[model samples]
Target: MSESTTDAATTASDDDAVAAASSSPGLSRRGLLGLALGGGVAGLAVGVGAGVAGGVALGRARAAEEAQTAYDFFGAHQAGITTPVQEHLHFASFDMMPRTDRDDLISLLQDWSYAASRITQGLEVSATGAVGGDAEEPPDDTGEAQGLPAAGLTITIGFGPSLFENEDGDRYGIADRRPQALERLPPFVGDDLDPAHSQGDLCIQACADDPQVAVHAIRNLSRIAFGRARLRWSQLGFGKTSRTTSAQATPRNLFGFKDGTANILADDAKALEQNVWVAVSDEPGWMAGGSYLVARKIAMLIETWDRVRLSEQDAIIGREKGSGAPLSGGDEFTEPKFSGTAIDANSHVRLAHPDQNDGIRILRRGFNYVDGNNELGRLAAGLFFLSYQRDPQQFIALQKRLSTDLMSEYIRHVGSGIWAVPPGAASGSYVGAGLFA
Candidate 1:
């Protein structure tokens, strides 16, 4: 939630606040008096400068709402991977533009980190976020990449500036990632979503034990950042994806049979480079800590997918059982190419198509999800695909090509979220510490 949007929330009417507090025994007389005084002062201030200043603050807050989600790599996310997570809460977010600051917006975003330091519980592993494989790499024994249970849950927020906040002023300027872009997504049914989200100077991400807690943290985080700007636009989700669960049900999306198996795995350069390469730290330069961008819709259909014969399902994804690999051979991170086209007319890449040069190759940080409950009876639930590309065009091209993937039969396109992850930084430094240059 951005400051502007949260400001738009309905507060108890002044009349109501006073009357209710006076009548109900919940709030003490002193507390009620303080509340009314604060409201009156705020109302007077808003009424007075409610034009230019208010507009700019709202604009600043709204500008922060561009949705850029990406999951953290093993080193930075999920401590003790040695222990299987009964449920994992992973969502990837990155800024569309990493270094966007019209004026002091950068400073405000930085300040948010300082203040946020007070509420968190975890060790943060920051890596330089440059992509494009700078001509160097981190030391093989750098120790910058292992044993992270001590690291803790962190809020990794990225910023994107080039994306439109609002084409016009006043009404829409307060939203980032212009609401206009949302029109492109296949309708997900709900109509209440804000067409555009412009909030905060920086995007805020919070994850924890419960999915709901993540949402709660996001809403409260506004107060810290809102001290300087407004909260206008934002979105939130909770918990690790369903596929990470032991549920076995592993619901597929609009497509079917365990989508998104090819990308995820333990860290190994040779194993994943064909898919996406993890940035190797080069000790102390731009390449210190960076990652590649991997994005794909890789759709799925739950109803039909669950019913398909296991053999057919394994073929769609090259993996033996969707542990995420190739039918030709190897487990999740093993080096198994979509090779051997002679055996099957449709190779895994022939089915998925990302291996073809024209398609985009982003670093994939996707996870599965299930919304609504038993009473509500879950609707569609599948991979919430996230990719971090040095350039958006790369990922966009990949999405276009995947339209032909065989998996499309089981998956229906819905809910598209994008984010740009900034290069990593030492814990004390702010998220976009390097981009200003």
Candidate 2:
């Protein structure tokens, strides 16, 4: 039951008594006058004050109760990918333990799937929750999110290229099922990749309107994965840099330019099918409804960018700083007029535009991150670029085209990974279940 209801029930009798006494008709006019003039007045004042306090408490409790929001865990497509982007993100990539075998990995996936489903519903990870397990043994859940709501939590999982064929060679014995487009991304120009943060065998993206809820989802999932998969790297992100739904307003990147203004919206089914989802004829059969994910941790050289002239910045981005409109003049969504305009020929938007790339497009769901000041006193901030496409080449082609863009000077790609997001699990199955079959 909601806390508001409990509070109302607890105070209902007292409120009724106050109303009854105040409304009683048996008292004489002098008695009523005396009641008003004597200590009865103060008593009534106290009663009214108590009622107001109760009402305020109940209102707050009701607001808190109503704050809890949830998303369906089971669907044709995973929740986090195409789900309207949430406010916070906790993304993690894991490497399977060497000692873990195929069966062990499969079992871990099953356990994780079940736990994720329960958690997204604002329930404990398991029925025998945080404290119900044996005292001597560690609890199944971490207990940090014990009283918290789901906050619209959604967990999406993906399989990295290395998961199929790594240095250890087909660790899980599913190398044969690896999609042709799931190979590691080719090095791009100006890439300063950190090997430690670049790749993983598996990845989970947890997102929610509440930071704690997003973190808790990853924490519990990581705990459940203890002996099976070790965390390789993780990135916490806030302030979504892109909008996947029409309901949301376009958000800005650390560069102060509106990002993803021309991004593919979730409602465009034709665009999604053409540019995002992997069709049966497009790749290995297991990836039919899935898509390829390319994650890049691009570190923005904030100190340098800040020093650039505003006009130069506008030219670099090919859009107005205030309105995000093309230099050729129009609203944010207006198509760029490449001919006879101040927009740089090598500007970011012009090169990244679909018209420039043979109508190729990708669904971008990026976020801005600030990791604190660097040792050199520069703000360590950047865009965590996450894009999904029908094929890996879509990203490769775009990156190649942008290699010479003026904006590249202000940003450096520090981490990158490419993963084949498997088709979503059926109600009774786990993610990547098709590969196992």
User: What residue pairs are clashing in model 2?
Assistant: none
Q: Where is model 2 poorest over a 10-residue stretch in terms of lDDT?
A: 40-49
Q: What would the TM-score be for candidate 1 when compared with the true structure?
A: 0.50
| Backbone clashes in model 1 | 74
Query: Taking the candidates one at a time, how many backbone clashes does each contain?
Result: 74, 0
- Supply the global lDDT for candidate 1: 0.36
lDDT of 1 at 41: 21
The clash number for model 2 is: 0
Q: TM-score of each candidate?
A: 0.50, 0.84
List RMSD in Å for every model shown. 18.5, 16.5
lDDT (10s digit) by residue, model 1, range 1-437: 11110111122333432332222122222222322232222110001112225557665543222111112211222121211121224332222223333433545444444323322222111111112223354211112213222122335564433223533332213243222212222333221223343222234445443343233334333433332334434333322333221222333333333443443333433433333322443222332233322222323456567788877766665455646546556654455555574224343445444556454444444455554333445444555555544444555555555555555576655434443345544444554455444
**Candidate 2, residues 1-437: lDDT per residue as tens digits?**
11110111111233332332222122223222222233211110000012225557777675454346565555566777777777788888999888778987787777666666677767766665678867775566667788887776778899998888877887889989888778888888999999998889999998877677788787777766766777888888888999988877999998898999988887788898899888888768888888888999999999889999999999999999999999999999899999876789899999999988999899998888888788898888899999999999999999999998989998999999988888776765677888899
| lDDT score for candidate 2 against the true structure | 0.76
